[model samples]
Target chain A: MLVNVLNVISQWAIPLLLLIIPLYGFIKKVPVYEKFVEGAEEGFRTAVRIIPFLVGMMVAISVFRASGAMMVLGSLLKPITDLIAAPAEIMPLAIMRPLSGSAVLGMAAELMKFHGPDSFIGRLASIMQGTTDTTFFVLTVYFGSIGVTRYRYSVVSGLSADITGFLVSLYLCHRLFG
Target chain B: MLNLIWLFLLVSGILVAAWHGNIEVVTSAALQAARDAVEVCLNLVGIMALWLGIMKIAESGGLVNALARLLRPLMVWLFPSVPPDHPAMGAIILNLSANVLGLGNAATPFGMKAMQHLDQINPRPGVASEAMCTFLAMNTSCITLLPATIIGVRASFNSANPTEIVGPCILATASAMVVGMSVDYWFRRRNRRRRR
Candidate 1:
């Protein structure tokens, strides 16, 4: 019963925001169409700028996967993650989570295919994907676009947060679904 | 740091593939990944345009400022270096709120704008300011209320209950946000002490 309500809310959340914000703009007598076009023009430019970074990261991820490096890394980290009650199969997803969204999305799809989306590993992967942002990607594109060279402390905090998210996802999945 | 990671990924991947006699796999993968990258960017274009357009209307209508005002107290505490009335503050607030609402595409433009605003007031041109680091930390660990993308993927995969992970996602993100903020605070304090 509770799940149904939350699901409904989540479904409506984005649509409502899209509708209400524009309505609010109209009410305020703003030139909504012009402003939207202006912002979207910037968005198009930003999207173009991100292509190089996206390709670089994606190619690297592909190499990591095709070369079996991802599996090897996952194996190497298995004992440690297992000791902490995390399934080793999902380790690569956790590592890739903060790096590239598309890479991790692909990983999640693979995991769901192999383990079934209802499986514990699949659930954990889904939660991990949802909870964490692409840290390195964001830093690169956002900071790179603005030319912020020295990203002191940002990487540390970002990765730490990712670790926390991973651990929490594991714990929550185990407790809630296991 | 990013350079090292990139280098490691490329070298290790190629080395490992060579050792396994699967060099062809690496070649094919790279080509496929390049194509995928273009596809991903193209997918983002529509989403980005839609969200950025909506966000612009919100900005012009003063909705962003109103939302920023509501979040100002907490934001001021988080970004002490930034003035209360600064555009950066509003941008950051809008970015975070967008993120929380699971508007990743919309959030990116706002986040980019926030970074630009933060950069305008940055004392050191190239070096990231304390405020920027804090903002980045928060952005990276922004608490997500709805894992919309994940749920959609799960549904596509025929999960019995697609939204089952949502509860856990929120909890996990909340924890991440707390840890991120704490680490940012620690780093800020330590950096200040070093200067003294």
Candidate 2:
């Protein structure tokens, strides 16, 4: 029941916002069209500016992935997963969650497909995927956009969040579905 | 920091690929990712323009301010460095809202706008501000209400109850947000003390 409501809300949200923002602005006597064009003028420049930073970040991440580093890392961390009695299957998803959003989603889908979405591993993967943002991507894009190279504790805090999210997902899934 | 991570990723990746005898794969991946980066930016230009333009109308109409006002108390607490009436506050609020609503595409433009606004007041050119760090901490683990994509994926797999994970997802993300905010607070205080 709640999911249905949420689905409806998500479906209607963007359309409603798109209509309402402009309608309200127009009602408030704002020069909506001109303002929009003026604001949009910065878009190209901003996108272009992000190219170098994005390329650098993406190449590093791609190289890491293509090197099978995750598999190596997964085996290295096997003892910890074994110690905690957590399913080893979602480790790759957990590790990739912070690094790349699309890659992690693909992992989650694959997990769900192999294990069945209603199974413990599948449900855990689903929750895990939902609970954390792509930390590297966000940090790269946002800071990169503003040319802020010295991010200081942003990364520390971001990784902490990712770790916390993963642990909490594991705990919740175990308690609720394990 | 970022410099170290970048170097580590590059060096370690090549070394690992060499160890695994797959150095060629890493080479292609690097080249492919570089091109994909530009492609990704090109894709973002359209939505960025559309949302930014609409955001301009919203700002000019005073709607952004109005929305910001509604979240003033919370915004003030989370971002003590930013004035309540600042454009950054409104952009931050809009960005968070888009994120909670699971409008990923819409969220990026507003987030970039927020970063720009935050940058305008930053004292240092290349260093991130306290507010920026806090904002990022909150953003990276923001409370996710919909988790729409996950649900859709589960449904596609013919799960008996695809939404079963919704409640768990919310609880987990909320916990992450709390931890993220607390860590941000701790870092902010530590940095302040160090500077003193």
What DockQ does each prediction reach against the true complex?
0.67, 0.81
Model 1: pairs clashing at backbone N, Cα or C within 3 Å:
none
Model 1: per-residue Cα lDDT at residue B65: 82
* Maximum-lDDT candidate: 2
What CAPRI grade goes to candidate 2? high
For this target, which candidate reaches the highest TM-score against the unseen true structure? 2
lDDT of 2 by residue, A1-178 (tens): 7668878888898889889989998899998899999889776577777888889989998898889887778889999988876788888888788888988999999999999999999999999888878988888888888999999999989989999998888888889887
TM-score of chain B of each: 0.87, 0.97
Candidate 2 off by > 4 Å: A1-3
Candidate 1 per-residue lDDT, tens place, B73-191, comes to 99888888999888788788878878998878778878887888899999999888999899889999999987777888898899998888888888999999999989999999998
As a TM-score, model 1 comes out at 0.91
